[model samples]
Target: MNDNILNTDREELVARLIDRPESFTDKQLEQILADDECRALYDTAIQVMHSIEPKLETNVEAEWNRFSMLHSRYRRSQRKWWKVAAMLAVVLMSGLAYATIQHMKQETWSEQKATESIVSDDTTTKTTENKQDTMQVQTSIAQPRTFENTSLDLLVGVLAEHYGMRVQVMNDEAGQLRLYYEWNPALSIEQVVDQLNTFEKVNITVNDHTLTIE
Candidate 1:
């Protein structure tokens, strides 16, 4: 016979024997025992059924209770897996949220520091520029003007005006100094006095606001 037909027959024999073993007649047992495969299947089924329950419950309610217990345990196992998966999802989302917040905070802090540094640099630069402007103004006020092709007596008069002093020529040699070369206009009154002392046969003295040249 085909495998399907054989399996069907084996299922029927196992079910009938498990339900009522004493219902089968002696003639039917003899016929089933004549086939070795059927006899072995029957013997194994009887052993399994007896091992399961010595006095098997015959009511539908007893079978339903057994099935419900097995199904409940299976459902509990499935719910446990779902619970674990839900907790893992929650943890992963929390981690992502924390990382995003930290990144945003770090970016904000960096930008704020950069802005502060730029403002500080600008303030320092403006302060330095103002100081330089003030120094330049003071230098312009104290600066002397250039002289070109000027005589000694006239230069002495100009120097008197430049130094805010009186010019005096005590000897004829004092009026003979003629300057042809360029002189730096930034020279101080003390420096000019020292230069005037280098002339031949000249004696110069500066006392407060009077210039005496001999």
Candidate 2:
């Protein structure tokens, strides 16, 4: 087509001719049909537009399907990850609870053992004191005498002075002297034995509360 003719009001006519070749007036139609260049340009533009239209449609459909598949997979992957995270959280919580329970159980057992030990030690001390008092009362009337080279009275006196114990020495009907040492609630049996054993001449026997010295 002539550039001037294409630039004038013929552009719309040219577009219309391309849309429908049989719709133009006879004169305009004759002008377009006689110009081989214009006719060839129009035919070529129409063929190009037609060829691209289905490919464009197919490309759009394919892109939409790809986007949908990607979106669906992303959502499924996110859900799967969430489930795994939730399971891990549950396992961590369970482990923490189990460890806490075990720790508590061990603490409780340790406390129980400590309490029992204290009670046992206290009971033993009280029993030793009670027996000593009974022996002292039984021997209070007898006269003090010597046995095993150390006088019973001297042994009792030393215990009284050093350990705050009250001791009494007496002789039984068999003429054998018995020494009764006074009990102290605070004194341990081991402590009492240690003190008495310091004097090698005396032989000592520790009953529940009483320390018998010969």
Candidate 3:
């Protein structure tokens, strides 16, 4: 016979033996044991079937319980991670809100300070202007004295005699008498001028009012 026919026959025989091993007739047993190769193949098939048989019902239950416990632990671990993630999100949001509030407060305070500084500067400027106006008003109210022609000549003569100075009288743009003096030593000019300005008979003021030298 061909190899394919022989293998098919052997497989069919093994299947029948596995299906009804106790019902095997003596003739079937003799056929299976007639060749050493056939006997070895039958033994191997029977051993394989026994090895592959389903486990006991109790063992199956135990395996199922172990799988359930392992699955439950895995689910618990996943839930814990989820909770940690949620807490982290909440904390981050709270921190963000606090930071935002702090920044706004700082900005508000800065703006307020800037406004206060501006107001203070404006007040200071106004006070300074007021003080200057008061001083000017006081100066405007002061009276000046007049000088006689003879007193003026006497004053010039005194300046020439005591300080070795020469005095010149000229007319200003407003047709008023302007007194000028020259001294021999240039350094003595300021001193001579100051002394002449103190003379009681000379009018030393140059504005609209007369200032009598005293």
Highest TM-score among the candidates is held by which one?
A: 1
Report the lDDT tens digits of candidate 1 across residue range 79-176.
77878978997997899689769966765675577577787765565566569768966675565543433456676677777668898888666566
Worst 10 residues of 2 by lDDT: 141-150
RMSD vs true structure, all candidates: 52.2, 45.3, 52.5
Give the alpha-carbon lDDT of every model: 0.65, 0.57, 0.53
Q: Name the runs in model 2 displaced over 4 angstroms.
A: 1-76, 117-214
Cα lDDT tens digits for candidate 2, 1-214: 4433444454565677878876656666777756766777677787988888764335877677645532343455577787897899799889978976996676567557757778775556556656865776445423332222234556555545544555544433212333333334245556656655543354555655455554
- Listed in order, each prediction's TM-score against the native is 0.31, 0.20, 0.20
* Order of quality (lDDT): 1, 2, 3
- Give per-residue CA lDDT, model 3, range 5-124, as digits (tens): 234467666666667766566666676666566677788877887899888667877676645432343455577787897899799889978976996676567657757788775566
Residue 162 in model 3: lDDT: 43
C-alpha lDDT of candidate 2 relative to the true structure:
0.57
2 or 3, greater by TM-score: 3
Alpha carbon deviation, residue 158, candidate 2 (Å): 74
Highest-scoring model, lDDT = 1
